[model samples]
Target chain A: MAQSNFDRRRINGPEESFQPTFEDDDDRETRWKPGNPRIGRGARDIRPIFLTAGLINQANGSAYIETEKTKIACAVYGPRQSKSTTYNEKGRLNVEVKFSPFSCTRRRVPIRDAEDRSVAVQIQQALVPAVRLELLPKSTIDIFITIIENDGIEGCIAAGSVAASAALADAGIEMLGLVASCSAAVVGKEIWLDPTEEEGKASSGTLILAGMPALGTITSVWQSGSMTPADGIKCMEACQERYTDIHAVIAQSLLDNAQNNT
Target chain B: MAAVLLSKSERAYIQSSLKATPPLRADGRGLLDFRTVLLETGVAPLANGSARLNIGKMAREGGGGTEIVAAAKLEVEDVESGDGVDGGRVACSVTCSPAAYPHLSSNALDELQHDLSVILQQTIGHPSLHPRNLTIIPRKKSWLLNLDAVVLADAGNVVDALFMAARAALWDAKVPRTRAVQYRAPEALKSAKNDVPGAMDVDEGTSGFDTRDMARTAADFELPDYWDEGETLDGREKWPVCVTLNLLTPRHFLDATPAEEASVPQRLHLMFSFVPSAPPTLQAMRLLGPEELDLKDLKESIAFGEQYAKELFTALETKLREEDNRRNIKARDRFALMR
Candidate 1:
């Protein structure tokens, strides 16, 4: 992985259009419904994605992504010798997640809590299948994800994977294919794609998955709460459908960088 | 990691830079121009009274390279014994955290704190405006004002920067009103005697009253009913400013930036107050350097520091008073709500 110096220059910008919400609002009875007119909609509101490649100068590769409301930064370090020698046949990947002290409304304490650790583990599980770890034996590539700001869990893990993959590619790390991740929540019988914080909280079920479109392989699978196996299959299908849009974004981010460098 | 060593030539170049300019250095201002100082109070949301000051950033002309931030925290405490007969005391501590220089020693912090304390004690605690006046209750309790100064970034001339921050923080500090409730004592109640309604005064021809007893009664019973009013009192504490003098070669600078500081061999720090309408008060003074300064240098530095100290105090007072007026207007709006 090659470290990029551009990341350090972009600090948290002036506060505007940032909203803080507590709890999810995705239940069937909730006054606000997903895709409702009250929520408003636009490419500017939902698109206008800000993406940057090669930020962490010390890391092999790094990228920062900011959607309408969410901001995620990822850095990939190494391909260096692995610390744990036991996994000698295949290379290893480790993921770490961090939130800035001022990332949230309330001061975020430095200590990593159970929730954060779980997210890190889940993210690692999601990306493992997409990365070609066996290409470099006895080596390890570390991914550090820092959530500068969070809007909603919708597309967060997928966004994180895209950032991680871009950073890894920038570092010149070999990968079987790019993995894209996204999530959907089932609130009551209704399936909501890209649930906001309010919707995610009210959701009775959540499905997070990652897959390599080129290879047609599912790299990660995660489900929480209660959802039928049929519902799970439906959500995965929806995710695959969403992948086309996410793939374009990942592709454009790299293309823009290539053009800028040229 | 091997330490990056400074060669002899590098040290000599730095020393030569110090001598390149004569007294009343390059900016054409006197030895005490003090670079344009900008002070703003109540900047820190969390602190009681926080201040951010930029000292000497103007000297860079258009470069805009140097900047410093100093914040002050003011806290109140009870007056301790042996601190005169005053019921309360105010402690002002200033910490300069230079973003440019992160690894500062504890000794440096202590030196800055001591200088600030002196300046505050002298001007704010002048003999006429005694700190004891701030005491709501005598002997038993008093308000102790604690001021903490923090330096957010270091541009140059931290002493001036620190002083500005300290002054702003002090202005921002609001000494809460202290109220005391005292129940009437049984003995005091017993001392009250009822006078007959519509009773006539005694004269020489009638029943006589002793003149000596009348005098004693007058002395003991005057305003006896409102004795409690005098028992508890509240007032504002005085404000003070810290002054630092940097000795560069044979020339003396009032506030020196980090670059200028690195060139200087010694520093003389003093905390003093001059209330223009009143006599100057000297609180604390210290000469910081490996080498000792002669009495003449000490006296000259003191004079130079005192002159700037007065100017800083006036500027701070005006700024604080303006803030107080703004607050009063807001308070009046709040009072309107009660009706």
Candidate 2:
């Protein structure tokens, strides 16, 4: 019989269709081992990274960075007049971070979810210290980062920090030093450096650190899950070491860009 | 719409310049010349279509350069049965960053959002421009187009950048293909279902429309496999692009910066969409400020707007073509490397 088209659920399907099942079903005890070749190398090795600056022509300064699994692009516009009337002597840095609806493994709603907003605020705090905002008064610099694809939340933030810093540098904004970041995932006794989506999901804890290696100042540190104080310190040290590597990559990228431009 | 407070002397300078035979703007551009535009599409990889446009380059010394980013995503969903329901829906939203205008009041922001939404809808949402066949399955399903725009920087002439970026994004958008199934009842039973006492008593007069057709055919409808191809919107060229002019009594300027906009007392927004075999037609026009111009001035502004719109359209087409070519080359190179 022909049915009326009135007030029908758009697509007829279960509210939650497919259940998530982990591909690695190895015994939990054997999942991560201190000396196992794969587990040991996985905890210390980072995916190859790519970084570029001045890619977004519209933005005063722009940078694009990508790892094997994570991709982020950032644009910096301003040092222009600020919209607020508060008489702040220092320049204001406004940071906004967004994940595209299709950026995650599962499609997300386009709206800025709580998680996105929180990350944005965290990023803003991490970046503020590195920028020499007192150089420009009554102006605000806007930094926007879009996570095109996210392999791990920690990795995304770290990459976004570096990219935003590069964009700031590209925009010719004064800064004390470039901020570089890295994340490590802790599973049992093993701390995996630059965890991919799979490793992040299986890990018990994550440690993310942002710092200006040259200035020896840690700009921001973020942690999720639980770990002993000893384990946390070790993870942080590993992240600091990784930051040096990232800083070199960024320095080289900016130098190459300058050479190409000239 | 002076975004910033202008002092008396600066205001006087602009007024005197406008009163001249040919208006000489502070930046010294001709009255009809638009700000230099730099637009790039496909900037946001995860979006179906995306574009970033800068109305003016960031000035090295002074305040200038309004930047906008726009993204368009299309989703297939059930639409109510109606005359134009098959043509699909377009929802456009504009959000300004607090950095755009430091002291922008919430009331002003809300008003700007409303005006932009209304103008964009009127410009891009023509039934003929978005055909039913492009995204419709009668009463079963249709496409809902969500067009979101964010103002990255507000140096001035935000409407122009927003509209241009929106048009570029839409031009780059693609709609996925879908297959629909129809369920037909047996002849004898069909008449009974249609003639049932309460069946005919449905809301309004639309009794024959099957709202549950999709639900009933849910099991039978063969959805597209992963390998199936998607479709781009038809009649995309008919989608309108906007051109806003700041009319300060006797003087009219195209693409006014915030400083210039503040000096003006009147502003007019015009949208034009090209016809297949005819000249571009005015799709919509609105006066933003309280002061209105005389009929003669209005006529002259329309003519200028139309001419400038054609130039912008040609420039956009060329840019899109160049972008497509570059994208194709990149893909080809990657494919070659893999092989």
Candidate 3:
């Protein structure tokens, strides 16, 4: 069989393999799906919650999280002044996503290019609604997310948003409540939670939502691909369920961090 | 954030601080002390391989603030002729993203990037073996290796931080394989026939020599006759480390932090390559300042840089060899499983 574009890109020697392009369907789907079955879970029960507090020494508060396959490091920089004058009504949040040159399966070219900007916008849109921007007018909290490793897109965006929130809280950013995000995808009539990159690409639809479960308000809702209204609702329900679990983890992480610092 | 201009008093105070101890600082470290240097390789999961280095005050931070992360990504492409005369060439590029230091301007970052790239090429690029030697496979197809360095936090001493990061990156780099076929030109074959007057008479008795025979002969003429299949071509590049010396007062420091660098009147950066059992080669050196350094200071800095380079090269080689051994063991286990 002819090699799939994803396989071809993945096996193109070690260097190029680091920056594998997500343009191909296979690459997109596989990378977006949950853990690979080949790895057989790897004693998940013995694994840590993949959470630790106070990782970013420079930031006010920071955290490092690694799920079975996904790894994310988030640093929260400040409640400092907003750089621009237009966004003065409320505190502004700037989100930046940087994939290290070797982050993917191909050698990623490090440039301030368009891709970085788009991802920044995606993250910003997902986060601004969740943050209590009006609380600290004229100030800004910068969330820097470095995706050390990505297993799938399903829960990643949500996980990353939650991680950002934890870092923000660690930084002492006041907010209405902790915002946790999670994703669910409809794969061949099955609702898979945190689908891997591969399963996500093959799924009929994906829904990513970030909210403060305690407040019962959805801050961000992003849906892609095709899905019936019922499917969307079901995915949203799945996301909410996942969010509750993730939110508890975030709360615990913040408490643990506070205790450690003391 | 708006820039904070250093007042004259601040600058003078820093200068005085350097001269107060006559080369020894309040930290109990000598003027030239590099602090404790620690390097960890293959830490970043997303990267092919990455390294983190902490030096000077940063090392004191205990892997916290002021750390540098350098990653190497290998790429293969049709070797272009301008890449040089060599068959296969490896090129490295280093960029420092001081996102943590938003006060740093783009222009300043660009200058540092250029400086780092030049240092890497001088230290690692081989005019004889790299691109030049790879050229034998034709420029149409070749592999290029790129190394990127990112500064996660900047407490100070970027040069030492960058150098250590780059060293770990180079040690972690793995180049892909390339196979080459050699054959004699038709004109050369015709010339060989003309040179041998009795060649036609013995043509029937002796086997005809085609391009493959010429290639075989050329291969045999070289040092080793049998090609070592399954042998890794990794880790062949020469190791070179760049040393940056800050000229402060009448004294010279091996590495200086951002604050120390700002206070200095002049700085000298030297790139040197040290191959084992051979004399060290000065790959490139540049002196920077508004005023030229006196001959005495220049000599002192050169001597310091050379000595530092020797120690650095030896330490790095030992580390690389150990890592290589671990990798070989891993490969052997995987191979055994396949059987």
Clashing pairs in 2: A4-B211, A5-B210, A5-B211, A5-B212, A83-B101, A83-B102, A83-B103, A84-B102, B2-B262
- Quote the positional error of residue A156 for candidate 2 in Å: 52
List per-prediction Cα lDDT, in the order shown.
0.58, 0.73, 0.61
- Which RMSD does model 1 reach against the true structure? 26.5
Give the candidates in order of lDDT, highest first: 2, 3, 1
Q: Candidate 2: misplaced stretches above 4 Å?
A: A1-262, B21-23, B59-64, B80-84, B133-136, B181-229
Give the chain A TM-score for each candidate: 0.79, 0.86, 0.79
Angstrom error of the Cα, residue B138, model 2: value is 2.4
Interface RMSD of each: 34.9, 27.5, 28.6
lDDT digits (tens) for residues B131-206 of candidate 1:
3444545544455555565555555555555555655665565444545545433554333432455545545324
Expressed as tens digits, the lDDT of each residue in B137-212 for candidate 3 is 4445554556677767665666556766776776665443345545556678666877986565655325765344
In terms of lDDT, model 1 sits at 0.58
In model 1 chain A, where is the ten-residue run with the lowest total lDDT? A37-46
Highest TM-score: give the candidate number.
2
lDDT of 1 at B332: 79
DockQ of each: 0.01, 0.01, 0.01
Best by lDDT: 2
